[model samples]
Target: MLASFRERFSMLAAVLALGVLVGSPDARAETLVIAGDPWCPVNCEADSQRPGIFVELARDIFGEAGIQVEYRVVNWARALHDARKGRIDAVIGAARNDAPDFLFTVTPVSHSRMCFFTRSNSRWRFTAVSDLGGQRLGAVKDYSYGSVLDAYLLSHAEDPTRVQLAHGDRAFALNVDKLLNQRIDVVMANAWVMENWLREQGLGGQLRNVGCRTPDLPIYLAFSPALASSPAHVELFEAGLRRYRADGRLQRLLQRYGVSEP
Candidate 1:
């Protein structure tokens, strides 16, 4: 009976040791928790074989630095909020404008030109922000398009009679329906995202891009201050991104996803 008890105690100790080795926080050192909107072609859900154009690029770049990645798909607002609160390690494919609290990298993970779309028959010719007065616009709830557009959204939308702006969770997809039903007159979104969505929804050529040819928004994988390893991680990621760009791997990846270089 004494011998049997000793053997059982030894087995229990070994199992506990193994559990510590497996469950230690240090074991997850190089793993990053990333979250974002699953904007197709721009950034897709994790289950997707290729993910999305920028999602794969970020994975490869960070992987080059020996980091493993886990992604969560959520609304843009929530993604930014969680990153700000340090519930996650980083925000994927985000701009500094999107999350001012997060630290951004000099290396951009992806590129996207912002544009506005209008129905073909609508007479909304956009030469300037003043022209947008009196027209209804569809915009994503938490999106920061650009300085000019953001200013207009903040200042002009106060009076619904002047420049009425409608907000939605899935702004691009919802805007398509709104435009068809005349619920909104314009949609402000990424050029590529909107184009892909329009094609998928079988509304190609139905809307015209009539906004300013704004410069592309260079997206970066920004880190949350709540993360203890943020500074070191951001440095490693920037180095990895530089190497990725130098090797021309980014171009090949974009081509695979039918995305163009900006």
Candidate 2:
């Protein structure tokens, strides 16, 4: 009986080894699906004329690994939702802690500074958080400014009416149009994005930066919890990222996409 058990175990081990050699689903065809918003300059875009820096970096890294990568451009809300559901493998170029459902990678590839924008002629000067009190402010929907800003706003719950959220383009347009129509007081956004949008919309001359939150926020590539469970893939990605950073390739890629070092 013991001899028979040993034979069965040996056969099982052989079968497993054969499976690995044959490239079974568990070992073969490692495909990673990444999602991001194209509207944001650093992440995603529909226009082939101008691709995002983060997308380019990811493509190069995965290409080196001989892994297949699929990128999907979706609205910010849908991207976050799908990431939470594990319907997507990863979310690229997201602000750390932007969503509670996803786990962030330890290394951040880029950073963005949050700033307040207003009409050049506006009287409001944003020196502190209190300046936002009793004033309508525009911000991208579902984007976290940071913990300090979030906590400050939450602690002053009585000023709920002071905050107003809008989608990215809409929020930016609102700021422009508000200043034109005298509707809102200020609009908050990442400095790069705000500048890009302003220039794209031909409204750069009409806006001015009032003040900005200190300590620029870093953006990270976030993975769904499902993907995080696979330690192998995580290590692979980190290794690839480290290689890119070490060779100055990462910085060059960012510069190619108009992302200056912050």
- Candidate 1 residue lDDT tens string, 1-262: 6754653454344334333544643323456778887677877768979678767766775564445788888777788888778788887777778777788878787776887789998777777777777778777766777778878888866665444444434655776788778877887778778887878778887999887545777777778877666765666566556556767887788788777766
| Each prediction's number of clashing residue pairs | 1, 2
* TM match of model 2 to true structure: 0.79
Question: Could you tell me every candidate's TM-score relative to the true structure?
Answer: 0.83, 0.79
lDDT score, candidate 1, position 15 = 34
Please give, for residues 94-137, the per-residue lDDT of candidate 2 as tens digits: 78668755666567777878888887887787777877876677
Question: Could you list the CA RMSD of all candidates, in the order they appear?
Answer: 11.2, 8.8
Best by TM-score: 1
Error of 2 at 94 (Å): 2.0
Would you list the C-alpha lDDT of every candidate in the order shown? 0.71, 0.67
